[model samples]
Target: MSQNTFDGVRTAIIANKVDGIVREMTNTLLRSARSAVINSARDFSCAILTDDDQLLTAAEGIPVHVFGAQLQAQALRAAHPDMREGDAYLDNNPYVGNSHAADHTILVPVFVDGEHLFTAVTKAHQADVGNSIPTTYHAAAKDVYEEGAVIFPTVKVQTNYENVDDVIRMCRTRIRVPSQWYGDFLAELGAARVAERRLKELVAKYGVETIRQFVTDWLDYSETVMAKAIESLPAATLRNTGRHDAFDPFLPDGLDFGVRIDIKPDQGRIDVDLTENGPNVDCGLNLTEATTRAAVFGGVFNAIPARVPKNSGAFRRVVVEMNEGSAVGKPKFPHSCSVATTNVTDRLINCVGAAFAQLGEPYGVAEGAVGVGAGYAVLSGRDRRTDEDFVNQLCITANGGPGSAYADGWVTYGVPCVSGLMYRDSVEIDEIKMPIRYKHLRMVPDTSGAGKYRGAPSFEFAYTPTADPISVIYPCDGQIAPSKGVAGGEDGARAAAWLEDADGTRSQLPNTVAMVLQSGQTVHGFDASGGGYGPPLQRDPRLVLEDVLEGWETAEHATATYGVEFIDTPDGLAVDDAATERRRS
Candidate 1:
């Protein structure tokens, strides 16, 4: 297969056909997965990778999981030269290519006749990954031994579409929830198989040579699109630093991350230097190779136009430099990357976006909310209905998105990693599955960062357990350092968590928590809002009045923060022209 051979129309048709196959894989996983986090929250990703290290998600991929997909594919092929049809492999070793041990990924080789063409990948976050503490994000774990999740390094799980009983038995014996694990495993396998079947069908319809040409043409096209986008930018070099809150007794002063970007418009390349970041600590917050690579590119892709295809061709435009054993670089083996998917990864991404803001107007967004709080905490307990054990993370609450150049931040924007892709779990499903009851979930007033186009407001969530007790674990951050605004915007509120007793006594909890919740006690969490984009004084008065009317902002906040005076009319709060003018001046 060579370049400039296939017609554009034929390339598009074949590309759509292949992408549709990937969608089928996504649907299979979503519908068949067993865990609440998977079937309900949609904490999984499906993608197809070329045998030659190019990743093709079309648009169906998670930033964290699929960013360094080539690494996993490389490891898979290197480990097994005997790869063939009807065979499957599992790789969850962060030390290898996986983002973290909690994500159980299934890889199946898509074979056309006897030639292996594509690999179907389905990565899903498990309810429990056999960790020592039951929770997946073991921020306290000093190393891999303390993390305790079984590390599978590209092990063959199936041959000729038949299960390896020994491997299955090993997982069943080690994991906490055997039946649930098996179900999720089957769901991932089913997704890969579905992709394999669909891909094979596509190849047969178009022939292998035609499909190969499409791959080549698509990659070239994507590269040209990204190159053109980069060439349009005014060349500039920017340096920025982002910080993570202290780990209390361990890192009292916290960690600082330094990022330098050299935008080369002539060469159509953006060079990101992460060599100046802090060294890796003993905690689980250290990043694996997969996550470290993904976080940087994810941010670069985000700062650019949405039309640029996020394939390997586009990825080649950005050159990344990482120092060995650095905190945001490559981690040595045995370092606990349990919380690799988020934590520092989120900050690194925000740093890249914020750095691009130096290029001036409409280039980048303000730093969005960072870290996972109690709202997305991992919960484990006995289900009274089924008389069985249960452990799953909730996805009911999310951090607000940062304000952009054109519009206000999205209210339901999740953590920077997910980018509003994950599904918000149904309260009814939570109540039915686990012995838990929801108290309330709502947005707090006057909590969003104020600017011309304001950021989204902070949200609060509260819940209680019906059982005697349930273990709750969360690696909460973003308390001391709130999401900072760019282009003269304001900062959002800090995150906070509290436990209210049956007698209505409330006690503040730390950012990082691993506690057991009593039956009557309720847990409440208020996540921070995102940063604003421009000066609030420049904001439209009508938008400020709308916020006051909607209760997302109060009249006092509008007058003080946004400098918009509101007068109560029979209809609602309307902007007062004279008072607003005076307030603004």
Candidate 2:
């Protein structure tokens, strides 16, 4: 347990080993999970924590999920102070430290001999949690009680490595898709076990004291790296405001969110003030204190250099303050936060990112209309192929990303709080699993935020139900307050959703609503585009020509937006330098 025994080389190796443990845990869950959301889309995270609940290491996954893993473990221990070996806990209540009700965490206590050593945690987005609706994003819920899923707050789900029958019975009876739900539950459990086993192996190999010392050294190293990075940033105090479209009926005018950040490199602290933010409303969009902290950490960690490890040490220099009743801070009991982790979390991070950009920080990106998945649609029906029930929420990877200063945004950047590593479900998989068929799926033309470096283009698609009737729940964002660009960048296109009936009649589905799709009915949607960075005229003409050639931007659209001229050539399309110069002049 001596500091002299752990050198820089040994510390780095130990850190990698800890990271590998979580990676193996994630792989175990992905392999065992049954739902497409977890198996294919990979909406889960794994983290190893110290006995006292400090984050030691984590797998690369959802930024919010990984960031909140520490909080989740702390909550677990706080609720169950008598936790022992073979004890497992489950919690999805945002108020109790989870990101949202749908993001359930499985915590397993690791013990070496008779001493408590570490905790292995796995958090995943369950498609359904015995909610009133089938989707995790329940935008229409008026209150927490009506949000559908029953909140399990640090409850003992397992004891002595055996399942608790009452918990299993409740989940099985409450959920519409019990088979899928139980399968996912077991997968989470399996992931926790994998981490527990790996941690024990590490202890067996390096002795508990030595492994503990390595953790201490590794955390200190991460702190030093982050401190250096923070000291190098420009010292400034910035105040910025951003808006998010609130689907809650109480906030028809939308929500006004604000941030005041003071970057003091000398003190190695970035103080964020959220007192000026809007108050809580009557919807599932409310954010808990833990979620707010996760969002703020996400912004800081993302804008910093990649050398800093996202552990307890990296957050030492950042301070965040929020009003108790604010939408982005503390939430009272029974305030619905079912959809709190998506659009609202994005808005907070967007505000912080914009503030950093105003300070001339090189790592800041243009405001991304992140969380395009906030407006996800959930479809549920009895599959005729197997005569079994099915429920699914479209993965956010179907949407495009927001623009950045250095490059155009990536297509389907996942959500704001993710690492942009999530995979979108394939059309073939959808047809085979669900009772629906895709009629068309392609990127929309001219929807990218037009700028020197354009944001990624959005997509539009249509799908028809393969059965006589199927229920659908629409929870979407970016319709009213789309993603905005930084500097001279342009705003991306707004999103749209509607259903075309068999009789050729069309009806628009509100951002938050539930309806039924009949046989021969087709659902159509247009995803929002990312905000542009810099000015359109500053874009390279050759890149504009490439955009036109790729059909992402029409010739006329390119000329109007980028002040670039494109001419038809035998090779397809060529930039007209002469005409482009004239337009620029």
Q: Highest lDDT: which candidate?
A: 1
Model 1 scores a TM of 0.98
What local lDDT score does residue 346 receive in model 2, on the 0 to 100 scale?
80
**For residues 1-585, what per-residue lDDT tens digits would candidate 2 score against the true structure?**
245665888787888888888889989998999888888778888888888788888758677787767888878878888888898998887876788888888889999996888988888888788788777787667688898788888889999999998988898898889999899999999999988888898899999878878878877888778888889888888888877776657567777878888888898778988887777877777888777988888877755545788888777778888887667888877778877777788877766775666654255666665544322567788888898888977663456666666678787775566636677777787677788888887887788988778888887788888865888786677778888877678988877777898898998766666778889988888787777777889888988887887888988888888999877789867888999999988
Q: How does each model score on lDDT?
A: 0.86, 0.79
- Which lDDT tens digits does candidate 1 get at residues 1-585? 245475889988887887888788889888988889999998888889997867876356778888887788899988998898889999998977899999999999888879989999999998888899989989888889999999898999999999988888999999888888899999999999989888888888889898888888888888888888888888999999988898766556777888999999899888999998777788889888889888888788767655887778888888899977877988887788999999899888888987887787778788788869898889998887888998888988978888877888888878888777888899998888778999999989999988888889899999999866999999888988999898899988888999999899999988789999998999999998899988989999988888887898888878899888777789866888998899789
Candidate 1 has its poorest 10 consecutive residues by lDDT at 1-10
| Top candidate (TM-score) | 1
Model 2: per-residue Cα lDDT at residue 206: 92
At residue 192, candidate 2 shows an lDDT of 95
